[model samples]
Each structure stands twice: as structure tokens, then as C-alpha cells.
Target: MGKKEILVVDDQPGIRMLLTEIFTSQGYRVTTAETGQEALDSLYAGSFDLLMLHYKLPVVDGVQVLEQLEKDQFTIPAIVMSGLSEDIMKESQQFEIVKEVLAKPFNVEEVCEFTRSILE
Candidate 1:
């Protein structure tokens, strides 16, 4: 099989760069966007094995993106990342495609392992 693909959305350049480097090292094909609109555009232009996003995104929040994905009938699996409290994180669990909600300040190893598990 070809390398699994991932669309990672985060507004911070440093975080985006970090994730790109990490996922690339893990042998995954990764694309990134700084805004939910850009993510949606990318989604329209291509398909990915998974979607990883931050809850507090610019233009459109993560929840809105999930709503849009649902409306468009895209059921790809997703991982939501945020520094918000667990109670707040629980909100994103409502989406069927969102398989994980990772709290921020998470270990890179954990993230890598989680992605590997999902892509497998």
C-alpha cells in the first residue's frame, strides 16, 4: 500500500512545522493548513487517510469544520488537538469521524504512536 496521508491543520507556524517534521519522519504523507478554510479547500482538491486539527482555528473553528465535513458526507477519521480542558475537549467527541481528541502539550512520541495506530 502507498504511504498513508494526513491533513494537519494548525495556525501556528512553529506547531505546523513541528508536526510536518514529525509526521514526515514517521513515514506518513502529510499536508498542512493554517486555517479551516484552507483545510476545506485542500479536502476538496484531494483525499487523505486522516484529518488532524486544532480546536481553536482561525476563519472556522474545528467544530465548524466537522459540521461542514458531515454536511458534505465526508466520513474520514480525525484527531482533534487542543490545550483546552477535558470538559471542553469532550465537545469535539460528538463528531463520528473524530476518533481522538488529544490535549495540547502532549508528548511527541505519544502523537507519533497514536498516528501510527490510526493509520494502521
Candidate 2:
């Protein structure tokens, strides 16, 4: 079987590059998008086993992107990452499809392990 594919969506180029490098080194297929719209476009073009999304995004916010994905019936698991406060986390957790939320400055290994656990 092929390696699992992960889509990393973040407005920051540094974050995107970091995730791309981390996942690639771990033998997973990694794709990236700098904005929510770009991420959505990438999703429409191909299949991905998971998504790592930054909460605050350009063009469309991460929550909006998640809503759209739900509307479109794309059930891929997602991990939402943000530096937001507890209230935001509570609100985002209302979405059933969202598996987890990781705060910013999180350990890269934790993120990778979470992804692996869910995808496996």
C-alpha cells in the first residue's frame, strides 16, 4: 500500500514548510496550501487521508473551510491547530468530524503521532 497523504493548510509559509518537511521525512505524502481557498482547491483535485489546518487563514478561515468540507460530504479526519484561547477550542469542538485541536507551538512529534494514530 502507498503511504498516507496529508494536506497541510497554513497561512504561514514557515509552518507549511515545516510540516511538509516533517511529514516527508516520515515517509508520508505531504501537500501544502497557504490559504483556505487554495486548500479547498487542492482537496477537490485529489484525495488526502488527513488535513492539518491553521485556525486563522486567509480568504476563508479554517472553520469556514471545515464547514464547506462537511457540506461537500468529505469525511477525511482533520486536526485543527491554533493559538486561540479556550473558548475557541470549545466552539470548534462542536464539529463532529474534527478529531482534535492542537495549540500552536506544539511539538512536531505530537502532531505526527496524532496523525499516525488517527490514520492507522
Candidate 3:
């Protein structure tokens, strides 16, 4: 099979870069979006195996993006990342696509293992 593709969506440039680099190093095809619109655009434009989304964003928040996915009937799996991870986790329980909630200030190895567990 081809390498798994991951879309990393975050308002924070550093997080985006870090995830992109980490995933790329692990032999995945990674794309990044700084906004929810860009993430949705990427989702509509191509195929991705997983989504790593930030809870807080300008204009279109992560929940809004997940709502859009439901509206469009996209079944892509997602991991929601947030400083307020517990709040988002509780709120995101309704979305079947959200497989996990990752807290910010996360461990790099944990991120890798989680991705591997989900995709592999």
C-alpha cells in the first residue's frame, strides 16, 4: 500500500511544522493547513487517511470543520488537539469521526504511537 496521508490542521505554525516534520520522517505523506477553510479545501481536493485538527481556530473552528464533514458525509477519522482537551473531548463525543482527543503540550513519541495505532 502507499504511504498513509495525514492532514494536520492548526492555527499554530509551530505545531503544524512539528507535526509535518514528525510524520514525514515516519514515512507518511503529510499536509498542513493553518485554517479550517484550508483544511476543508484539502479534504475536498484530495484523499487523506487521517486528520489532526486543532480545537481553536480563526473563523472556522475545529468543531465547525467536523460539522462540515458530517454535512458532506465524509467518514475520515480525526484526532482533535487542544489545550482544553477535556472540554473538546466531551463536546466531540457526538462526532463519530473523532477517534481521539489529544492534549496540547503532547509527547512526541505518544503522538507517533497514537498515529501508528490508528492508521496501522
Candidate 4:
């Protein structure tokens, strides 16, 4: 099979860069979006194996993006990241596409492992 494709969406440039570099190094095709609209555009533009998203973002938050996609009936698997309290995390998981939630301080290794765990 071809390399798995991952769409990494985060408002922070550093996080986007880090995930892009880490996943690229692991032989995954990675794309990034700084906003929810860009993320949805990317989703429509390609067939990605997984979506790695940040819950908090500028102009249409992550939950709204996920909800909208779900409303449109896209079954893309997703991994959401957030620094908020655990209660918010619990609340965010109501979306069916959210297969995993990673806290803000997660390491690159954890991200890699989690991605493989889901996609493999």
C-alpha cells in the first residue's frame, strides 16, 4: 500500500511544523491546515488516512469542523489535541470521528505510536 496520509490541523505554526516533520520522517504523507476551513478544504481535496487536529483554533473551532464533517457524513478517523481541562476533552469526544484525544504536552513518539495504532 502507499504511505498513509495524515492531515494535521493546528493554529500554532510550531505544532503544525513539528507534526509535519515527525510524520514525514516516519514515511507518512502529511498535510497541514491553520484553520478549520483550510482543514475542510484539505479533506475535500484528498483522501487522507487520518486527521490530526487541535481542538482550539481561530475561525471555526475544531469541534465545529468535526461536527460539520460528521453532518456531511464523512467517516474520516480523527485524533484531536487540546490543552483544556479533562471535562472539555470528554465533551469533545462526542463526535464519532474522534478516535483519540492527545493532550497538549504529548511527545512526538506518542503521536507516532498513536497514529500507527489507529491506522495500522
Q: In order, what is each prediction's RMSD in angstroms? A: 1.0, 1.0, 0.7, 1.0
lDDT of 1 by residue, 1-120 (tens): 898899999998888889999999888899999999999999989999999888889999888999999889998888888988496467876788888888887789988888888888
Clashes of each: 0, 0, 0, 0
List candidate 4 segments past 4 Å from native. Answer: none
What's the CA error at residue 76 for candidate 4, in Å?
Answer: 0.9
Writing each residue's lDDT as its tens digit, candidate 4 over 1-120 gives 999999999999999999999999999999999999899999998999999989988998898899899999999899999897386578766888888888888877888899999899
lDDT of 1 at 22: 94
Worst 10 residues of 1 by lDDT: 85-94
Q: What lDDT does candidate 4 reach at residue 92?
A: 69
lDDT (10s digit) by residue, model 3, range 10-92: 99999999999999999999999999999999999999999999999888899999999999999999988999988998999
Top candidate by lDDT: 3
TM-score each candidate. Answer: 0.95, 0.95, 0.97, 0.95
**Using TM-score as the measure, which candidate wins?**
3
In model 2, what lDDT does residue 100 have?
Answer: 83
Q: Which clashing pairs does model 4 show?
A: none
Sort by lDDT, best first: what order? 3, 4, 2, 1
lDDT of 4: 0.90
Q: lDDT scores for all predictions?
A: 0.88, 0.90, 0.94, 0.90
TM-score of candidate 2 against the unseen true structure: 0.95
